[model samples]
Target: MSRPRSYDEPSVLSGAMQAFRRDGYRGVSIRDLEDATGLKAGSIYNSFGDKAGLFDAAFEHYNKVVLGGRVDRFAPAAAGISGLRDLFISLMHEPNGESHGCLITNSAIELDRDEQTYRHVCTGMDILFEVFLNRLAAAQQDGSLRAGTDPVLAATKLLALYQGLLVLVRAGRDTQALERLVAAEFHELETYHDARPAQQDIQA
Candidate 1:
């Protein structure tokens, strides 16, 4: 019978993720992973196949465990505008040391030439955009957003703003500045409501 796995896969993967997040894929070596994960070369190879394989595993873990929780916070917001606002606020409030911008956005910048890695990153971005689009559509239907607002366009703009904020935060932008920037964008959403009649506002 095949031998059962001997090490703590989740723990090892979490360490690997930290290493990968600190250094892009090309920068992480087997020795680095070995030190980070406390797994010998042979053990890592045996379990995960190669460095790329281990990175893929770590990326998946980070996505589900870290980014996933933040995204989940917006899932219950009453409308797209609220959800988008909440999402930006969460990013601004992210703990100092834990703020590394975004793993997927970093991957996108570092792995653009690698088709497999690019595709994986693109899929994650697509899911985020789709979620925003769906929420925006719901807002439009309920009159919380203007009737003529293009859900896809609004989603794209929000995504750009969010990703840009991530870049700014990673560069050491002040937390208050980030908060103000996000609040300003959210305030613009109110203009749409202002154009609607008072009765429509009550229905929203």
Candidate 2:
């Protein structure tokens, strides 16, 4: 049999993911991976094949561990719209220093020419949009959102707002300003749904 594996696969992959997240795939060198993972060149080559292979594994790890958790926050709830609102608010409230914007967004910027990488990033984005769409549809069906509000359009707009917030956060905006912008976006969403209660209805 071949030599037994000596390294901690999960921990090494986790380190590789963070390194790739902080520096784009193109920027991360074999040396970087080796240094971050504590895996020598030979071990990395034998276990992961090459830089592209390591990146593919690392990207998947990042998606599952980092990005995947965020999209799940939009799960259907008593107040679907409110759930979506809270998800966005939490995202914007995340300490600015802790965010690297978004891993997929960063990958899109750096790996525009690589079809495989581009497709992977697009697929992740599609999943996020679909999650928002489901929440918006539930809100519409429950009458919490106004009739005639297209779920697809509303979802798209919400996703755009989220992506824009990521960009703003990456640009070094303060948390207070991000919170204000997030609140404004929520107000805009309510206005779009024409969701104001009448004065008479409130009194009753």
Candidate 3:
């Protein structure tokens, strides 16, 4: 009879994820995953199909566990904008804050568009894009944002900043610097309600 599996799948995937995050797909080998996960080659293949399958699994884990954590509170329309900000705040302070950047962003740049791993990367990016889009639209309705603003475009811009932060972190940029830059951007927002009282007085 086949021997029962020895290790916890989730735990193993988590370790493998760190390896992938630290070293891109092309950089890691089967032996590297074995060292990272403490599992034999046969076990690795039996559990996940191949290197690509294991990567896909690990990428999804990074998505739900790392990126999607604490994101639900911002699901409401106006709250999503806060959610976006909260996400970066949490990211800057993520445990083991070091050279490791976002797995999805790294994979997006490192993996081929036609590679299987690319789909997960795209899916993760889409999730962030959707969250930002929802929040921007809500802000517009609530008058927190100025009129004539396009939520779709604004969300894309926010996503760009976010992705850029990931790169900066990998390049050893200070989290404090990122915080200041983000704060400045938020401060520049011209809320519609900020001008409301003046407009009413003018009408009077």
Candidate 4:
């Protein structure tokens, strides 16, 4: 019979999650995880089954606690562009005070081997796209967007924008520069001006 664990599962996973964020999948070794989680190899193997299992747990934890948590803030913001701005600003902050980069985004670049991980990331992105697409449609209805602007296209652009920004942050771009870049994109959208003037018929 196996004895109950002395270590907390979530705590161990949370600590390993931080190490994964900092070292990345390929960069981190079994020894690295051991150091981060304070669990011996046998315990890790017995508790989580393997490194892959441990990583899968950690990835889900990061999504819910770090990345997905940002979406909860959307309800309070004005929605559409204002809510999007708040979301973008939140991305600049690191998860658990580790500025390495998004665990999902980082893992995304190395997802050639793991089907389960890839599916999770893909589903997460699709959920994000659906949420933003609806928000963009709402903005159009409220006249915050151009009368003829395509909500689908705008939402896709936003998806690209945030993902690209994460890579830039990982590349060590200056914080001021990152903020300025965000400001420039928002300024180009002219969101500060009153909702786009209604379109008028030009027929004679």
Candidate 5:
């Protein structure tokens, strides 16, 4: 039997998530985790089993709290295409101007071909994709999306654009340029959107 943890789990996981976001899985050391989580090496090992275990937990935390929260805040189901545009815009303006890069994007690049690491990356990516798909579907039903637009394809494109933008941000690309790109892409979607309702009216 193992001893119960006395420390705050969410707090510790948040710290670890930040560390992992700033530094890739291999880049973060045991000592670094100690500094980040405020837990001694023995305590960490005893609680999490190893660095990989802690990283896994941290990754899950990021997906659940950070990514999920952002989606809920910016691009909820009812927000539709406008909400998705805001979601993309929000990515450019990181809090406090911080740009540690997205965890899922960074992990996908750094841990490519590693099935174990890709599992978490895939989960995070799927979350975004699903959000895009569901939101677009809602937009279509509400006659906000262009008639005949395929939600799945649009969602996939948005997912790719999202990941690409994150890479550009991490590479120190200009924020204005990225924002403009997001605006232009969403503009096309909006362009068709305006015609959608009129088209529906004509059909009716």
Candidate 6:
């Protein structure tokens, strides 16, 4: 039987993800990965067939773990619009207040349309879109969403806004301005209800 691996898979992937996020796939070298992952070249090669394989594994980890964790922490189904606003706000406060940048956004900008990483980028985007869509739909069902706002359209706009905010954040744009913009957008979502008369008022 083959010998069992000694290294922690999640730790390795997390390190590789940080490397990839800090520097795009083309910018990161094997030596860089070795330093980031704490694995010798031979062990890296043995555990992952090649650099591409390691990157793929790391990208998947980013989608499943890091991104998923953020969604779970900030925007669960029950949380609704407040959750989404919190999610948007959280982007401005990444670990150490440093913008390593999102792997999906970085990959989409760095990789070509025909590249394999393109599919991974799409997958990550789809995850966020689905979360936005589902959350909006739930909010609408519960009467929290604005009057006559289509959940599908709102979710699409949210997905776009979310990606754009990440791009701006990575560029070191004024985060306070971005936070204010997010607040304005979410404010619009709830303003209609504020203007509407309550049930007792309607009856009176």
List lDDT for all candidates, in order: 0.78, 0.76, 0.79, 0.76, 0.88, 0.90
Best to worst by TM-score, what's the order?
6, 5, 1, 3, 2, 4
Q: Residues 116-189, candidate 3: write the lDDT tens digits.
A: 67888889889989888777777777777667778898888878998998888788789898988777665544
Candidate 4: residue 54 lDDT (0-100) = 89
User: What lDDT tens digits, residue by residue, belong to model 2 across residues 1-204?
Assistant: 988898898899988887887777878888998899999988999988888788878777767766666655544455477767777777666564666556777887788656665666887788779878887777777666656778899889887887887777777778678888777766665545555789999899
Supply the TM-score for candidate 1.
0.83
What TM-score, over all chains together, does every model reach? 0.83, 0.82, 0.83, 0.81, 0.89, 0.91
Q: Which candidate is the best by TM-score?
A: 6
lDDT digits (tens) for residues 22-41 of candidate 6: 88898999999999999998
TM-score winner, 1 or 4? 1
Global Cα RMSD, each model: 5.5, 4.6, 5.2, 5.8, 5.7, 5.1
Assess the local accuracy of residue 183 in candidate 4 as a C-alpha lDDT between 0 and 100: 74
Better of 3 and 4 by lDDT: 3
Candidate 3: regions farther than 4 A off: 1-3, 73-78, 190-204
Runs of candidate 6 exceeding 4 Å displacement:
193-204
Give candidate 3's root-mean-square deviation (CA, Å).
5.2
Q: For model 3, which pairs clash?
A: none
Off by over 4 Å in 1: 77-80, 190-204
Error of 5 at 180 (Å): 0.8
lDDT of 6: 0.90
Reference-based lDDT, residue 15, model 6 = 98
Q: Tens digits of per-residue lDDT for model 5 on 1-204?
A: 977788999999998989989888888999999999999999999888988888889899999999989888998877889999999998888877677678899989888666575799999988999999988888878888877778899999999999999988888899899999999988876556453467668898
